[model samples]
Target chain A: MSELWAASALSVRIAAVATLVTVLFGVPLAWAMARRKFPGRGILEAIILMPVVLPPTVVGYALLMLFGANGWIGRYLGGYSIAFRLEGAVLAAVVVALPMLYLPAKAGFAAVERELEDVATLMGANRWQTFWHVSVPLARRGLLSGIVLAFARALGEFGATVMVFGWQPGRVTLPISVYAQFEQGDLNTALPTVLVMAIAALGLVLVYNALASQRD
Target chain B: MKHALIRLVVLSAVLLGVPTARADSIRVGAAVSLKEAFGEIATLYKADTGETVEFVFGSSGQVAAQIKSGAPMDAFVSAAKKQFDDLVKDGLLDVETRHLVAGNELVLIVPAAAVKGGAVGGFDDLKKDAVAKIAVGEPKTVPAGQYAAQTLKALKLDDAVKGKIVFGANVRQVLAYVERGEVQAGIVYRTDAKESGDKVTIVATADAATHEAIIYPAAVLSKTEHGDAAGHFLDYLMSEKAVAVMRAKGFSIPTDPAPAAPAKPATP
Candidate 1:
């Protein structure tokens, strides 16, 4: 029972940190994808969606190259010695879950009625005010779905986290610990870990479905 | 007539090249520590025999599972005796063709800065709060894990170190844990610790008698259609050239007494 709490707490931490990072990058990207009409919009969308299609290992290695101790970003951050620990796990999770957050936020942004923004603008609301006050409230449903889905996606991420963090228990998130257990053939120990993850996944899906309903 | 003869020669060359190209490409499941060394061997093998060797370098347990579950493999080189023995028991390996191709030593290593070049210390320090985490291989599948567990039990430190012990999926992972400074110390094969270079610190060597002798075995799978080719590869793995490569990679020569029955009694 204590072990279950420990594992669940770890999972929740990973999901929360990943969610926070995703929102930091996701909202702006979603806005751009929604409001900007650029020449390479199709290519940008494809690049953003690449994680959904690319092998998780490839994404992991890319993350490793970008954030490994000797990696470019990693070295800069290594002044603080930050990669391949809990922070690296969160970063890997964020990269994979970013698209899940971005696509839905973009859709939600798009779904905001143009007339509401027009009315806000005519009422002396500036662009930023119209966005924060008008646009966000109108499309809250899609944004909520995106956040839930993003958290769920981050929670289940195994490959990228494993390759980046290399399964440092207690420091790495839960998916890695599950994989290490599986590799060790302690399926008995692993069963609880799997159950916890599954329930979390199911909870996220339920939340997404509820928010999606609100959107409809 | 001349043009038709030229076409015939070109067609014959293409047909022969196609089969030889396919035949030359052979896949071998190698232990993780051998990744770079085997890559070099593969190049040599290609140069000498025109055979291109592809290696899937990972934990021997993982490679063995993959092979047992029908991964297309011609040969398997494992870091432990049990994996090969189990493969033989599974009827996947040709029983008569197995060989003890190499041996490795498990060592207790710490960050170099932690211990001032001391000839490896005793386990007494391991229990101290100063030692926050100790990395070790998972005992179920990784040979290094089994050896480390056995050594711990032999020294009666298993219970003492239980809380501070962090399990790695393989010996390499154990090294990574220590190298990344996530763990204060770790147990890995001497080869693996060496592979970490200055990233890790080696505190001491585990007495060879403390646990079972670490013998690595290699064998050709019975299901291989290229049995002759695999047999040749196994021969190379046992040859002087291969021994030199293994030695350079930190595989010890088995000079100790025979491996005891594994720590836990065999399941039978």
Candidate 2:
């Protein structure tokens, strides 16, 4: 029972941080791609959306090359190794869930009428101000749904996370715990953990649907 | 609906739980083969001593590699002597704390219904047409597979059963195959066979002499911060109580003190 709670706590914490990071990077990129057409825009979109189509193991491998001690990105970080730790898990989740948020948020941004932004600019609103005040408010539903979708995707990520940070004590997430228990034939424990994840995912999907529903 | 977005953001703020301080727990890296028994022992250990034993179960090689790279494990329990010896050579494991926890026998298991059939009796029977596929661990990686291969070669049955063998990733997968009747039989650790309960029946024990000795060795990591705590848990694993649980799980207790039993009570 305590194992269940510990796993849940660890998972929620990792996924929360991952979701926050996803939105931080995802929202901006999504908006950019949604608003302007730049050179290599198709290539950029393909890369951003690659994670959604690629197998988690492939994504995990790419991240490993970037973050692993011997890899380019990792070599620069010096003494900070993310292997088998919270940060690694968060990174895996963010990579895998980024596209989920980006896709919907792009749609949300695209749905926002260009006239509204023009109206804000005409009223002397700066680009940043118009973004926060007019663009964001108009695209609220798509963005909200995207955020929820990303959160749910991150919560369920397992393979890439495992590949990035192999299993570790004090780092067990709900999916990992369930897999561990099931491997040991301990269905009694695994079943409850599975139930917890199922409920969590269901709740997130509900939130997504609620936000996506147009009340006006 | 009016402030739904604001409420949702607040909700995420709560879900973004503040990182809590780690509890008084020692992280132990152990072989994947020990997953079930070790988990049970950890649970009991927590009950007996209010301290926790958190584990990271993986292949002996993977776990050892992690330890070498400074994976923050307080203790290590390897499924084979080779991995333990390698770590000891690297001065990663405390030599003094190292001990032989248990040894294991390779068991041949078949689906429950096939147990009584005369069609499959021993290693030789695996060659028969009735046994279409016989599951064993991949000899290159899985310890159980290596031992099973050794046993067949030692018993002069390797050529006879070679064509019928289907390799699994690990002992647990072999047991799963046997339990599902996907394979007519499987060769896996005794503990794995036992975990399947009645779903699979042990057809034969691949005598210990036929293969290299299967040993599980444990020791504290020399770099561990909680040396005393990890040592205590290691001692508990070799304690009479924990040994009893391992024995019931079908593991061989090699150095277990001769049990004080088989004598009638004086009163009786």
Which candidate wins on lDDT?
Answer: 2
Instruction: Please write out the lDDT profile of model 1 over residues A84-108, one tens digit for every residue.
Output: 4678778878988999999899999
Show pairs that collide, candidate 1: B110-B201, B112-B201, B120-B203, B120-B204
Alpha-carbon interface RMSD of model 1? 3.9
Number of clashing pairs per prediction, in order:
4, 0
lDDT of 2 by residue, A1-216 (tens): 887888888888988999999999988898899999899999989998998889998987787677764446775776244544578889999989899999989998998999989999999999999989988888888888888888899889988987665544344788877765544345686888888899988899889888878684
Whole-model lDDT for model 1 versus the true structure? 0.77
> What is the per-residue lDDT of model 1 for residues B1-268, given as tens digits with 9 covering 90 to 100?
9999999999999988874334556678877867766776677677778877788777788888888889988889888877777787787887556666677788888766556644237666777766667888777677888899899888888888877777777778888767755567899988888878888776678888889878877777889887788778777766567667778887765553234422432458
Clashing pairs in 2: none
Q: Which runs of model 2 end up more than 4 angstroms from their true locations?
A: A1-216, B1-22, B116-118, B256-268
DockQ score of each predicted structure, in the order shown: 0.28, 0.02
Give a tens-digit lDDT track for model 2, residues B109-162. Answer: 888866766677778788788876677875644678778889999999888786
Query: Which candidate has the top score in DockQ?
Result: 1
